[model samples]
Target: MPAADWRASRLVPRRAAVSRAQVETVAGRALGAFGLVFGAQTVPTAVDQARFMADGSGVAMMAVVYGAIAALAAATFTRVAVRAAALAFAAIYVIALLAWPFLVVDAAGMAGRTPWLYYLCTVATTAAVIALPVAPAAAYTSAVPAIYGVVRLSPSGGGASALIAVLDTMYAVILGIVVLVIITMLRQAAIAVDAAQEAALERYDAVARRHATEIERVKVDALVHDSVLTTLLSAAASRTPAERALAARMAADAVRRLDEAAVEVPGLDDRVALTVLTRRLRGGVAGFSAPFIVRVDGTDGVELPVEAIDALSSAAMQAMVNSVQHADGPIGRVRRELEVRGVGAGGCVIRVIDNGSGFDPAAVPPSRLGLRVSIEERMVNEGGSARVESVPGEGTTVTLAWPAGVEGSGE
Candidate 1:
């Protein structure tokens, strides 16, 4: 495929996919807000029924139930303790239902009117759906409405007809089940998306590594054709001392080139000082179109495989280029930083950070080789890893680490 056509086909922007966590957050907040609205609607009924309750029990029930609902509503906007709020709303509503008969001043006097708790049955079940797992949520959904049904049959629960009570119970159960099914499906779909994305990334990484290997193989082949093959042809044709000496020199040059190629192969014993790697990184950063605040530390005497140095340097430079191209905004608006530091025995870590126009890492198209190929896969090919953290409009940080358990490496 033509390069532009290939990129155009694969690089088309995909609609940002929502993860499970994001789905849950939206569900929680929506349920909480709905619960609050339903709770508010119950206020007048609660006031009218307050007369039938025993001393202080009516006020206490209102306080506890309303307080829980209020907490649920408050949790809609804040991330703190959301599950706890949902649990409290569901559990408190159940407890209030169970205590209704005992709290009533005259059980029979409550006949013909629905209890305020009846308005919140669906709300409680919705909270349970948000707070618990499918099995437990289903159980809670069934049990809470059944409890309300029993309370409904009692005199304090308005002495409703069996048929009426059954209808109400079924209504709440069906609604709860509907909510449960919808939420469970959404979560399952989100999980599937996450799994698919992870698998695609793994496949892309493997393909990228294979591509790098093929390029190296081609380089070796080219070296053989240009150097070794030519030297052999020249040596075979030599008929004089001067010509033979020239052929011998050509053979020696080819041997040196072959030796260098072997050293360049990954996993070789050829080592370079950490300082050499850092120096290269510094030079690259200095040459960038925009200045980067560079910091280097603890790279004095450490040594690493030559392949590792090359991979790290290339990945780090690619990360910087990505920042400059994508993250850098107007002049003097963005602050870019590059840090190269040695860690453990001889491993190194590089970080490129920019306070500029950030982006969603998850939204990046697979065809963007600056990240998946030039940075991430390059590090993985060298037995290292890269992490990119960014939020749209917040900032971006790309961290590259070599030799995976570098923290605990012994001298």
Candidate 2:
């Protein structure tokens, strides 16, 4: 894809799909709220019946049962157990609504004194609508009221007339339908917002990675110009066999540096023994004209991520190469050392030390890729660090350490 098209595609926002469980939770909460309100409205009727009854109980007990169901639905919506419990409570609600007349005394005389009890059908239907599938919700919401209306509006029944009973029942049914529609829309909206946020984050990450890659490419080009290209030109201009030989070595060193750059620290999860890393470092410097000694401490049973190994080994080799090419003392007399130390905390420390004339590290220009890109940047990229210490007439020590242990080592 073209850059502009790719950018637009990634940046464009879209709606996310809502999960069934979330919809169920929202529906459960809404139904639970309605049930609580309906139950509260029945309180006065419950108190009145309790006062008049010989045992001070009857319809009032039924109100308590309904309230308990509402509370249980509300509480379990956030729990995993709600799936089964919610359906069970909804079944009890539908049965109670259908059996309303049988459960109460003076059903006809009670009349409008308990309008809220009729509305409880709305509460139960809405709960079912939230917790149950479409087919079952439609069946229960429509069936319970259809049965109640028949029993309520019959000629023998002394409650409300047909028109009034139908209107009252319609009030609950229509409200339930409206609430269901609103819940559906809200659930869809929630999903859309979530999708948009995720897309935005992914796009931001992709852009960041592209920018970093471009910057590194420029740095590598500068490195080649300063090191490899310079050595090649010097080789072409040499006047003597000795000068040509030295230039050839420099050009070969430059080529090797480029090749080494291709060997990056493996992913944070890969493991390599410390002994293996030390061997690799020695192998990289085998062509050095000077004496190079490698010392190991605490390498037993120590393993690190591949990336950590790559960074430390490459940096150490670079330090040794610098000693071979620039150290002012006699090649036979000077002692160059590379030490690998492992911390019990799964950390590794590598130091390259040499007793030869050294230049101030600060004097190295920004254009020098050997120290900046090869040593420091490589280490820093892998959660490790490299520090160079040197002064006039004193040898240099390049220290590389990963204090956080190997990446993804579970340390």
Candidate 3:
């Protein structure tokens, strides 16, 4: 199964799953508001503090530029544009924090009273970037504090003589790392929960399908037994060769029906084109030395799975083979026909008909692979069905139909 399809399965309850979009929305809004307010307040302090420096006007301008950009990014935050928002704000915040080295004067001391604002904005930006996968989020989260630590420890910066600046900034860096790790763990846990939910739903579906199949097998068994008994009685009382032959054919069909009941079928994933399937079916029986004609009706443009097409095509060819080898008579010629047609929405019907000395459908032997394993079982496994329709002296039709998710109907 594709990853996208697995994630999209409706089996997982909506209330039970925690979606990435949901996380992004809540986190983005919270952090966006924080960035706007905090950046607004910090800009004024940063400007005023820069005035005490010998050459601090350029530093003041840098603060205004980055602060404005961060505020704008937060104001325009969107889930779809999360990465862009995160990148824009991260750049501004990290650059602003890096300016701490320049803000630190040999004698004027730290510029902004709230130097911690630069480090805390890193935390806010981390919240906004939670939509990113673990690796990129970790990198973005780490880069912010690491850059702050590097600039703060410079000889000409905050580390000039005070150990307090290094200690204060180190505490903030450690706090940011812890927050990022916790968020990453939570994201991973949510994904695991969703996967488990989907698996449980699939198991429940399988059990239900198995129970339904068991019920269907019981019904098929009863029908096959009754048909077999009736054919046996008819054959015993027959007074002519024609009557015996018809009875024998009916017996063969009954056995085939019994065979169908005994076999287990797996579910089908539809993904093949109906037109392509018919063409393949035609090619499948090309080796037969009998006259065969393939007629397609309606649009053959419908697409289903390749397995589905194979099952239908294989069943059709088996029907044709059965007719050539069993339906032929001394006077009758084999006339095999493969017909493919579209049914309802995303549905298909394939009929393998033959004009020959047809037998009674009730008399098919249990050991006959043609109708049982080759046709009916094949169709059933593909979430489709096959039924044999025949009379004593007319013809036989093996009808196969796949109607999307509906259980196959075969007799």
Clashes of 1: 0
lDDT, candidate 3, 244-302, per-residue tens: 89998988988887776555332354354566665555555444444566666553457
Which segments of candidate 3 are over 4 A away from where they belong? 1-14, 53-77, 103-121, 124-161, 201-216, 229-411
Q: State, as a TM-score between 0 and 1, how close model 1 is to the true structure.
A: 0.68
Higher-TM-score candidate among 1 and 2? 1
Candidate 2: Cα lDDT at 229: 86
Model 1 weakest 10-residue run by lDDT: 5-14
Better of 1 and 3 by lDDT: 1
Query: Per-residue CA lDDT of candidate 1, range 63-84, in tens?
Result: 9999988888877545446778
Best model per lDDT: 1
Q: By lDDT, rank the candidates, best first.
A: 1, 2, 3
- Tens-digit per-residue lDDT, 46-159, candidate 2: 555433333423555565557566655555443334446556666776565555555455554455444334646676677666667666777777776766676566422236
lDDT of each: 0.79, 0.63, 0.59
Model 1 stretches with alpha carbons more than 4 Å out: 1-14, 268-411
Please tell me which model should have the higher lDDT, number 2 or number 3.
2
